[model samples]
Target chain A: MINLPWPSGLLAQAAPAEVDYIANSWLGIASYLIAAALFILSLKWLSHPRTARRGVRAGEIGMTIAVIGTLLIYRAVSYKWIFIGMVVGSLIGAPMAVWMPMTAVPQRTALSHAFGALAAALVGTAHYYTLYGDAAIDRFTMAILAVEVLLGSLTFTGSLVAFGKLQELVPSSIKGLPNQNAINFSILGAALVVGIWLTASPMQHWLFPILIILGLAFGLCLVIPIGGADMPTVISLLNSYAGLSASLMGFVLDNYLLIIAGALDGSSGLILSIVMCKAMNRSFTNVLFGRMEPSAGGTSDDIYAGKVKSATPEDVAMLLEGAQRVIFVPGYGLAVAQAQHTVRELATELERNGCTIEYAIHPVAGRMPGHMNVLLAEADVPYDQLKEMDEINPTFAQCDVAIVIGANDVVNPLARTDPNSPIAGMPILNVDQARNVVVIKRSLSPGFAGIPNPLFAADNCLMLFGDGKKALIELVAAMKEG
Target chain B: MHNLEPKLFTFLLATFLGLEVIRRVSPLLHTPLMSLTNAISAISVVAAIQVMSEGHTTFNHVLCTLGVIAAMTNIIGGFWITDRMLKMFRREKPRRD
Candidate 1:
């Protein structure tokens, strides 16, 4: 019986131990409600580019409240372990968020999903351990816990592998993958069978670890065959898995809040995955098994290197000076270089010079969907000035100068010309149809899909090589000088 | 000041963290995430309803009804919002093509 300090006469008649416990409990609950409100507000605010930063802050507040509540509720031998966990998580997470290059944003997103999955899995495991050897625990509870743990672990490992692939730590596309679909299906089937077995015999705890392993393997199999281009879909699918795991864990623990939150996450993740699939004009099944290997015997370097012609900033500036209509195509490169402000400045200058400037946005530009929009909006680019691919493709033909910044596959002509190309038949921005094209890029590197674009080598195209941010600033300066 | 209070606190904290994760990832996932989170937040409805059905004080009953309504709004509103967003993504077939 631990003695609790409370206001005098508040709980004088009650046992000191119970009084203290109750007070602490109430404190915890109050924190949780506050956190929930913040969470809801954060999500609502995040929907638009205007409030995204605020949304991030709100989310942080909620997470802080949650961490505080968790620490207060759990009786530990010492606070050392809790502090250590917090410190370590922050040390790793902070650098990853700030220092990580925008080029590696996809991998970073995947890693974040893995962290989320790991947290859910850890919670589920802790719940199981807390109830270990309790015969009174029902079968349904055990089954839910097992499922949560399995899915959580699977999502964790799968997201890590995705991160690896996206980071180019692993090859972007692997070839000679015959009957990959059969292999993926077989693994999934085995995982399901093992999951059933684990649920049937919770007393045999060894099956729990085996189920986790099977799930892990299944996640790897599911993601490994997927091309780098399809990473957005894969990340979304893993997010769903993580959410489902959390929901199942909530059910096991009879926590209504957990169940609600987890289910929401899972369903949304699923929907997003479907949306990404649609954006790519690919089905979910095709995303999983479709291995779009670069053409055999044609190295990535061979396809892009020396084939393209370069232009100076002065040349690009002169080209822009005479152009009546300039269409800007922004891609991941713009985001990586954090060139939104510079791009916006250039647009403002162009507009001031009486050049009709319009931005062309592809559905699948940048690492995430709406990435360009968010970046552009941050730089105060007008919403009406940004045109979707379908709306602007026809207008490009009449434009005098098409300025492509860090965009490759989305603007590539190979998608239309090469029958064997992985990106074949995908509708691309018709920047090629423009009178003169100025491609701003850091280097002649292939896109995430590892496919070399022939548009850079086209007679109409002049590659302006430099960091997107630097190039845009120089372009703005040159325009001002002219 | 009760055991349940601490549980509530934990729930709130977890909810906030979960929401942040959703927010950061939402641009990638789109409106479906919002709809899903809305559904998850709706769990308060179940809690409210269960408390009400248990035949607690009249205050509890009122609270429960409010919870249910909030949850229903989240579910119905979420789906409606998602449907609207999906409509935005739809490509109109070119007349020539």
Candidate 2:
């Protein structure tokens, strides 16, 4: 059989032979290039909701091509193990994809980041051990692998912690742990120092596992103190870490496609985390250190005492009846109660009654960035009616009734007025400017900032206290009847 | 090309391209966009494949198998969920004039 090498143009055709070295090589490169293009196109397609599905198709196809290309290149001694893995993965993953409610997207996303990072970490470990045993590892490869494993392991545990917090399986915030940030920094510093040591001396096999342990410990410490309000930034940061780990693994394994995909994922997560931090007027270090100030102070009663007016569902319905334009401000509480559908129902009733309906979306609303949009979109809320914070803030005064549903900080007037507050200078929905502000909340409980909202006590604001879903349902029924 | 120089170049350029593309994605589609990018990144399963084929030891295969499973799950689950979520974002039918 005749054959060409890596640079040969005749790679489109290959002679049949054992291993088929040149044939597989060209095919691999071709597949990776096509997959890379497809991946880029996939994200590009997401620029609009109308074209997003095509993007998904592109991503799916890209992944398919990459997988098939790998199988073509490396013929395992026994494909059974790889086959079993794929089958078992499909069995577990398909249900997770199909059964997860839209409200659980953030948790599901965190879990996936964990899985992806863990996978990369394991592969890197395997490669490192294999080379160590052969006594053939190089400095560059070792250094990159050490960093990869560190990042991958931390990302693995960080994403899990994030998932746990989002699932409420663990406390979302653990503050005032006495030098908590110091402890976290030390743990992270220990892991990095260990990673550097591992790079210099690959013979000290015990150090590799120590690095893993420290990485895992640091991830836990890093995420535990992050409050509920910082979830969007935390999740985005985890996503970025997971992607960077994978990218570093790509360098370790010399995989072109992995590098491109990882870079894309990393940059995407980076941009989102930045956006989330900006929305809250926070820095990356503040979120990284997991420092949130939840003052259990006298503000709640002091601000809310005699100034508050608690109303019934019927009162809210009556207000809606008289209102021409109504805007909804949803938050984490709405997600917690799974009240998006009920809110949609209320919006429909309002629409039918000739009331203009718009949803005001704060950038940092819900458990993650854009989370509220996904929930509302799932409820079949028209995309056009979902107005962003800046777009809708100026129009709040024209709104006769601003219904704050399971929301707190985003609509709090304090974010704009109080410079010393935790959420100070954060762009809020400006719901107070509306003629009548009705807050549908469970109670006078403070939000993640652990501060009382002055909006609840304003003369124009009426608190309709109840479970979010139940309250929205009652209001929807009343709206229909009225 | 001789060292990791070309790869570093590729990585930087790809990340820059990603930022621009992701920036344009409507905030409304951020959830789906995240899932899609993650699924694409899970293509590191190909690397896991290469590792599994390297040595005949049970330890290597086991680790590689587990790695493959994790990446596979991310790819399947991520794409499937992203597709489901994107489909949920719909526009209202045109109203009568």
Candidate 3:
């Protein structure tokens, strides 16, 4: 068990009266301050791509220093067990970092939140156990501990459910026990009661396990009803939960750095969640309780029986020769086909053909907020050419052509034309306003919202049926030959 | 209990400061921002280390060990994964030839 005397040996010899104690304590404080400074800088640098790599470096160094500082505090104690834990963690973390695909970043993030929250909860649980009934443990610390455990436990399971939905381990459709919302709320209520009771009566330790169980159940229930289409928001929300849990764990531990860092994480996550919801024209309550997309409507057979106007790559290239301005709108289909690089190459080729090319990015265009931007950025697309929805929506009409590349709902005119549409009221890229529109997709299928797009029927629209990357490559070749 | 005031003050300050920082981030960087923030929240590693180092009994040791493992996984995995993603999001394109 790696047993070592706590109050004896080095601890007794290095007691507060000794010079070593003062030196060690001062060193610890200095390390913490430096680490905190690095973390703040990292967050600031993370706001832009140019400095983001340096930001990651700063965070890594700060975390390393924090780990070292903690190890120094308990230097007198045997670290056999701690080292073992560190080894096990690295074993899992390294593969996940190296082997995970870029498309699965959202799910990876969810899993990270799950682990982080579970750590905070476990720490609070351990602290309460170690100091059980100790008169020195005050009510405020207990209350914070209760908060830490509650958030940690909920985020732990909530993030797991989110990960499952994103990975399609469990069906992404809404599945919940009867009276799911009511049951979830009652469980949360019960946990809060137990937490308060524990705060008031430290001796009544029997309530601790019950509180943990309820919180975990609440987390599972919270994310189970959310479908995969809303994974981005749910993942962000779970991140906020994990952050708040860490912040409260800081209070219980009297660690200011943890408090600040956790608060930063929590607040930013909440803001991102709100932004995602707003982009979808939905509220937090609706996102949490409402079904993602109603499945009541099927694609109308009459609309696409023979109405889809298919075009060849050569035809699109010929059309591009006359076009002076073109805007490319991308969505999840682009991501699915991994066509970002090919698309960028096509844009470059079009630019060379004496045409203006710009990207129109909807906030919720891909699976996550800014998913298309990341994919485009990876292909080294000029940042200036990448335009947000509001910035490009008005400019579409001035363009000669709008290239809708593997995108559906974002360019669907039904959002504005049909009030009863599932995606109604959601802001969309105005590709329909352009003089001519070209869509590169495999088929005239319904998008994530399960609604058929009427933009396909517009007289000015042309559908180029094929894989996104393959179609774009062919178009690029056609342009080169001409 | 008496230390509540300072803790609450720090909490409020952190909250406002965090929101202000988030407001400045462009929509283009939201996914990276989410991942980066996920990495930073691994600050619980500080508490996890302390817990493992301080626990006296076998039960305390085992429980704290689990916490340490989880916290380390979060810190290491979160930071490394974010770095890998950001590295791929450069502004320079690869050689065409």
**TM per candidate:** 0.69, 0.95, 0.90
Candidates 1 and 3 compared by lDDT, better number: 3
Error (Å) of candidate 3 at residue A297 is: 9.6
Worst 10-residue lDDT window for candidate 3 chain B reads B88-97
Each candidate's DockQ: 0.05, 0.65, 0.58
| 1 against 3, candidate with superior DockQ | 3
lDDT, model 2, position B72: 92
Task: Report the Cα lDDT for residue A298, model 2.
Answer: 51
DockQ of 2: 0.65
lDDT of 2 at A55: 94
lDDT (10s digit) by residue, model 1, range A1-482: 12122334335646766766667655656666676677566666656545544654664566456546544544431344334433554455445544544345456557656766665555555444434433334566676677777787778788888888877787865642688678767877887777777567656666766777877777777777666567767777886776676566555544434554665566557666766776666787777766656755356666657767899888888888888899999987887788888988988788777888888988778755555755675566666677878899988889999999988888978777877777777779999999999999988788866677878888888999998889888888888898
Tell me the tens digit of each residue's lDDT in model 2 across A296-335. 4456878988999999888889988878999999888889
Candidate 1: Cα lDDT at A100: 47
lDDT score, candidate 1, position A201: 67
Candidate 2 regions with alpha-carbon error over 4 angstroms: A1-19, A294-298
